[model samples]
Target: MDAQLKHGLLEVCVLTALYKEDSYGYRIIKDTSPFIKISESTLYPILRRLESGNYLSVYSVEHNGRLRKYYKITDLGKKKIEEFLDGWDEVMNIHNYIVTETRRNENE
Candidate 1:
């Protein structure tokens, strides 16, 4: 995927993952892997950005005597996701236009 496209999609994906449940960095990577390729390098900055944006909140829990940082979606995050979903229709429409237009021109 293009870097720019992936950047935005990844942010939404991260938010959605937190929406499902609060999770730490590695867990977020694991959860998102089924849908999108996410690694520590890719995920950390996104997490930081979301936390900074107030879309996510972070807290640390001691697990196995280690501190694990967990992320939870905020009200702002939910609102943002709704906005993304609402805007998705336009994206799908543009995709449909490209696909059908390409096919039509090809058949001609």
Candidate 2:
């Protein structure tokens, strides 16, 4: 996948992950890795950006005797999700049309 595409999609994936419930940094990394190739370094900056944007909020909780920061989506995050969904729909539609047209032309 293109780096740009990965960067663009990461935020959407992160927000969606948090939509169900709050999660800590490591857990988020673990969950997202299977779906998207993300680095721990890359994810921290994105998390910071989201928190600064008020799309997500974080608080620390002790788990396994370690202080872990848990993130949850805010109302702004929900709005962002809606926006991402609309954008994804458009991207998919365009991709499908192009692929279909290409196949049709090839068959001619």
Candidate 3:
């Protein structure tokens, strides 16, 4: 995947991960791993950006002998997800156009 595209989608993926439940950094990466290629370094910045934007909230909990930071989606985050979903139609339309055009060229 293109680096720019991957970066763009990472934010949404992280938000989606937190949509259902609050999760620590490693857990979020694990959840998103099945779909997107993300690592701790990449994910921490995304989490920070979301929290800075008020799209997510963070809290710390004691687990084992250390503190684990967990992220939860905020109302703003939900709205951001909705906005992405709404824009998906346009992206799909562009993808379909590209596919159709490519097939046409292949046939010709």
Candidate 4:
């Protein structure tokens, strides 16, 4: 995938994960693991970017004598997700065209 596009998608994915409830880093990674395997290295930078963008808010809570930072999606972040979803049909159209072209070439 294109790096820039992948970055934006990942940002939206993270936002969706926090849509229902606030989550900590480890839990977010674990929850999203089924679809994407994100390591701590990748997640923290994304978190920082989201925080800086005001897409989410971060707060530290005491967990087992340590501070665990949790992320909550903001209205702007929710709108970002909605915006991405609004364009889903175009992406599906492109995907279908690529598949059809690839299969047509194979049958030639």
Candidate 5:
């Protein structure tokens, strides 16, 4: 996968995951891992960035006597998701066009 593509999609993916429900850091990592291999260290920084940017809010919750920080998308985050969706559609369309053309040429 392209590094630029991964970087572009990471924020959208995180926000989309939270769109499903509020989740702790670990759960976010687990859920996204199947689709994208994300290191905990890398994910933590992105979470921090999103929180700092006001795209997400975090709160502490006690589970099994351990305090975990859960992240929830803010209204601003929802707006960002909308913007990303638009960008995602454009990127996918371009990618599909390029791939389809390549396949057609290969069949010639």
Candidate 6:
């Protein structure tokens, strides 16, 4: 996958992970892993970028005698998810076109 495209998808995936409930770093990775493989190294930067963009909010909670950061999707983040869903048809159209083009030679 293109790094830029993957980067955007990863950001959205992280937001989706927090859609239902706020979560810590490890849980976010575990939750998102089913849809897309994400390592700790990859997750932290996405988290930071999302936080910086005001798409999500971060708060520290006491867990196991330590502070663990939990991320919650903000209104903007939720809106972003809705927007992505709205634009999904366009993505699917592009995907369908690519698939057809790739298989055209085989069909010939």
Q: Which 10 consecutive residues of model 1 have the lowest summed lDDT?
A: 20-29
Query: Residues 8-64, candidate 1, lDDT per residue (tens digit)?
Result: 999999999889789889888888899999988889888889999999999999999
Off by over 4 Å in 3: none
* Candidate 3 global lDDT: 0.93
- Against the true structure, whose lDDT is highest? 3
Distance from true location, Cα of 84 in model 3, Å: 1.0
**Residue-wise C-alpha lDDT for candidate 3, range 1-108, written one tens digit per residue:** 999989989999999999999988998988989999898899878988999999999999999999988898999999999999999999999999999999999999
Could you tell which candidate, 3 or 6, scores higher by TM-score?
3
Which has the higher TM-score value, candidate number 1 or candidate number 5? 1
Summing lDDT over every window of 10 consecutive residues in candidate 6, give the lowest-scoring window: 1-10
- Candidate 3 lDDT score at position 1: 97
Model 5 lDDT tens row, 1-108: 999889867887888889978998888889998998778888888898999999999999999998989999999999999998778788899999999999999999
The residue-level lDDT of candidate 6 at 86 comes to 95
* TM-score, cand. 4 vs. native: 0.89
TM-score for every candidate vs. truth? Answer: 0.94, 0.86, 0.94, 0.89, 0.84, 0.91
| TM-score between candidate 5 and the true structure | 0.84
* Model 2 C-alpha lDDT versus the unseen true structure: 0.91
Locate the minimum summed-lDDT window of 10 residues in model 4: 1-10
Q: Give a tens-digit lDDT track for model 2, residues 33-95.
A: 889977889998999999999999999998799888999999999999999887878899999
Candidate no. 6 TM-score: 0.91
Name the runs in model 1 displaced over 4 angstroms.
Answer: none
Position 62, candidate 1: lDDT: 99
Worst 10 residues of 5 by lDDT: 7-16
List clash counts for every candidate, in order: 0, 0, 0, 0, 0, 0
